[model samples]
Target chain A: MAVAEIKIELKKGVADPEGQNTKKALELLGFEGLRSVRSMKCFQVDIGLEGDEALKACQDMCRRLLANPVIQSYSVELK
Target chain B: MAVAEIKIELKKGVADPEGQNTKKALELLGFEGLRSVRSMKCFQVDIGLEGDEALKACQDMCRRLLANPVIQSYSVELK
Candidate 1:
């Protein structure tokens, strides 16, 4: 068995409200010097395949449902 | 500037509804041979510090607000 570690993140130039809010909250909490904050979602899935097969499956999954291709980019690593 | 890659994930035994739903949805989408799915939140923060100082700051952020000490665990990587 292998674990497909997938990460989905917004493309550059996209606005990240969640990250912005978090940064604002941190500043309010007295943590300064924060330039920017960007957020990503990660999914770890255990699959029955290994090596290239697992990686391929995960990429397909990301394209199908895990990521928004229009505004987000995804990376998959099988281990 | 340095980027602090922060990851927040549920601790062992904590139920992850998001992961469960994704797995179920994938199965419905005809994805077979899947065993399990786990989800994590990642934050990329640009800080004015570097190396150990940056790593320490991110840890402090996680302790103060980014992570829920009770049910979630966090990791910080400086790059």
Candidate 2:
């Protein structure tokens, strides 16, 4: 069995409103002295196969869906 | 300076509509035999400080916003 670990790395300037809102909430809750926050998404899927073939399939997912290639980069670990 | 790495892991049955839609697109585009797909989000931030202090701040961010603790688990690595 092939396990695909998909990790998406978003650009620093992508305007993460969710992250920004979180920061404000944190400040209000007395988490003072905290400077910044960012968020990323990860996916682990079972490819039910092996090797480069599985890699290609997952990469396709990254390109077409898992991430916006224009704004993010993806790394895949096949285990 | 403190570097905070934010990772969000969503539940397996969280109804990833985006993922499902991606799967369909992949099949239509000729990539066959793909059974399932899942996705996650990650973030890396410079906390402008150091040590356990930063970890606590980031964890606060997770509890308040980075993740919906009811449906997700967050892990933080302070570097």
**Candidate 1 clashes between residue pairs 3 or more apart in a chain or in different chains:** none
User: Which residue ranges in model 2 land beyond 4 Å of their true spot?
Assistant: A12-14, B12-14, B48-53
Model 1 share of native interface contacts: 0.94
lDDT of 1 at A23: 94
* DockQ of each two-chain model: 0.86, 0.56
**B17, model 1: CA deviation in Å?**
0.8
Docking class of 2: medium
Candidate 2 lDDT, B1-79, residue by residue in tens: 8888887777766787766776677678777776776656777767766788788777877787668987888788877
**lDDT assessment of candidate 1:** 0.93
Instruction: Give lDDT tens digits, candidate 1, residues A17-63.
Output: 99999999989988889999898999999989989988988999999
lDDT of 2: 0.76
Off by over 4 Å in 1: none
lDDT of 1 at A17: 94
Across A1-79, the per-residue lDDT of candidate 2 in tens digits comes to: 7888888876767887766776677678777665676656777777777999889888887887668977888889997
In angstroms, give how far residue A33 of model 2 lies from its true place: 3.9
